[model samples]
Target: MKIHMLAAATLAMLAAAGVHAAPPEQAPHARVLQLDSNSDGVIDRTEAAASTRLAARFDALDANGDGRLQREELRGARKGHGPRGGHRGGHRHAGIDALARLDTDGDGRISRGELEAANAAREARAGADPKRAARTGHRARPDLLAQFDAIDRNRDSLLSRGELRSWSEAQRPQREAEMQRRFDERFSAADLNGDGRLSRVEVDEKMPRIASRFAWLDENGDGVLERNELRPQRGR
Candidate 1:
């Protein structure tokens, strides 16, 4: 259950992009349902593989790297360095509330048409009274429509709960791989002594973000990052 530096870095990137001011939380019940596919009370490698989110961080969550995640390990994954480190409870609830609003038909799913309608409503409101809209926080994000289209995988103009989950699952591996490649490049460049691990000074100079959370990543309090500590586990 050691802190996963790459995950933190990814969250940082999302914040920088203004996707959300804080990490979005996954509701505990939803998490169990999504990750524990078999309902066996635990997430094994096979189950985790079915989820892009879980699969990407499977290694880190499997504290012992035993190819399975017990309840304890799952709990650890939720623990993070600071307010912005882990998912924020308010954000999670807000997302659920937003989705509920978008599912106008109460079918528990959102269609592109419905989403567009909602966006239009928000836009109209904003145009009529910009100050009121701003004060009420009802303005729509310009990219929201594009984002909805991207997640509608079947091009059926509808976004079912399953479709949304599938889109995320599909994107997880590519994202994680790209992050891993970047981390490797950075680690190699920062390893001044050509050693596999990085000392505090090396991290301070080369990876300021990681350095800021050094205590969290140094799992053993050894003041250095073992090669494995900075890299994703193989085959993940």
Candidate 2:
């Protein structure tokens, strides 16, 4: 009787402590799938490469062959690049900060050479191991900064709606498809209410951190998000 009682007490204690557990790291099929994906932390290269084309196109517009571009070079890129009907005040610059600063050589014109250099640097780093993407306790590297600057359309430190729309429009179809796939995958789980749409309420309840993270990424203020938009915000 004593042995049986002791066993019962032990079971009770274990139950109270909730200690007989290795976490349910793998549960349902959907949960495991989400874990596999977010864990990889792979930035889609095809999408990144497609964005480079916009930089290239912008460089082509800077007639003087200098190595930096300004708002003037963005003649047809939404309001001549002056805010692009974008908002960049009260502690934020609408999505164009990097473009204004893309003058790698400080030549005041984003030339073909600058575009090539930026693209080369981006490709080199992107080709490295995913483990290296986030160096230990360090901030973004120069090449990453160059990548952001290369896409800043209004020459502002921030990206505006116009710039993002412009970039999306310029991307190759295949890259666009791949990026959209990743985006859909990332958001699929959190949309738990199963309404075939995402709501701020649902996102806040199921994925609050992602909701906060989305503010910087959703430059266009659209409900749907994209990786290109998120890339610039990774610094935040």
Candidate 3:
């Protein structure tokens, strides 16, 4: 029930925003990781301050008393697992907030009936000001709006959850391949010394974010970042 609710809430928000889920590699903890501005693969106290809720529970989530949040620590926190196995309720991941917006009767939950009504409301608004709606809808990724008509299989002129999910799944492989190709190009460009790895100095000069977390990403403490080190950290 909890998973389904979250999924529906997320889908509704995505449909309204006219954006789709990010690639799989970027989904898990991607929003939290974005706070790692230094890109060292963990969220420090300063970075945690970006989210007010996360900042308040930082110490409790810092299981090792390191004063920073590793990915697992955050994952545990989101799942309501505290350091002592207590439930840390209300870890914000946008689901509750999304529900609040869509739950028209303030019943604290969104039913299929409610969702359908909300969809109709959105379509009416879009009809009233299509040019303005188009501009607001795809603010996350303007490119998605270009493909909107094609993805709207029902021709209702509104993106339903199924259509968007199907489109995103279908585009996953191509998106991942393109991401890898771009990463390879950037890595080659950053490896100025023709080496297979990036020295601290090279990363600092070429990639400021990696430079901030250079020591951490250098898993072997070899004072450099290898190609694998630069890739997204999955299941961290």
Candidate 4:
């Protein structure tokens, strides 16, 4: 009788553990590493120094050297440093791609007006259907709007070099938060009961990009992201 009681208690603990899972895999893709540009393996003072290098990265990726990022620059069609925009025959290479919906005009060109749009589009795209608005959740969180305001400090109706430069101080922190938020927001939306937990069914709905990125967030080994699973420390 004593042994059976102990076994039942252990099984119950395991059952609870099985309920609230963690982010699936491991660290995000080499996006952060590649951002270093210098190939330092670890992103040092350069990337975190400010919006300077980042702005320059954005500029360089702009291809035309325009102050803004555009859809054309993001298209898999353009000729870039590596192999022109995509995987051709299992090619091993590096590349860049920004949010296409930010091409406000549908013209595929991202002007200063489109930078924030790109970021927003990226958040939505992570767990969203490209055909629908990304904000389709049970209760709208002010996070999205707050994100816009943070980047659009001047509120002049557009993002500018001055604004982006001023924002470099927030670059690293924002990256940390944004990366995590992108993961939680996806799970939160699918958690219909608002129980702060997710099952495999909800987990299966994850988008390709989300699935590939931040698998490490699932630390609990469950199929969902629980409150405790978000305990990662954020920083520059």
lDDT of each: 0.57, 0.42, 0.58, 0.41
lDDT (tens digit, per residue) of candidate 4 on 82-127? 3322333111111123333344776643355456555555556644
Query: Order of all candidates by TM-score, from best down to worst?
Result: 3, 1, 2, 4
Residue lDDT tens for model 2, 97-163: 3344445667455544555665566456655744544532112223323444555776765434455
lDDT of 4 at 55: 29
Candidate 2: worst 10 consecutive residues by lDDT? 41-50
Of candidates 2 and 1, the better by lDDT: 1
Best of the candidates, lDDT: 3
Q: How far is candidate 1 from the true structure (C-alpha RMSD, Å)?
A: 19.2
Give the number of colliding residue pairs in candidate 1.
Answer: 0
What 10-residue stretch in candidate 3 is worst by lDDT? 90-99
Question: Which TM-score value belongs to model 2?
Answer: 0.29
* Top candidate, metric TM-score: 3
lDDT of 3 by residue, 1-236 (tens): 99999999999998999998675665546777777765656665545544555655654454333445665567754655323223343332222232334456765543445556655676786688787556433122232355667667878655554555556546645554664675677678779998899997887676655466777667788888887766653211
TM-score of every candidate? 0.37, 0.29, 0.42, 0.27
User: Residue 91, candidate 2: how far off, in angstroms?
Assistant: 8.4
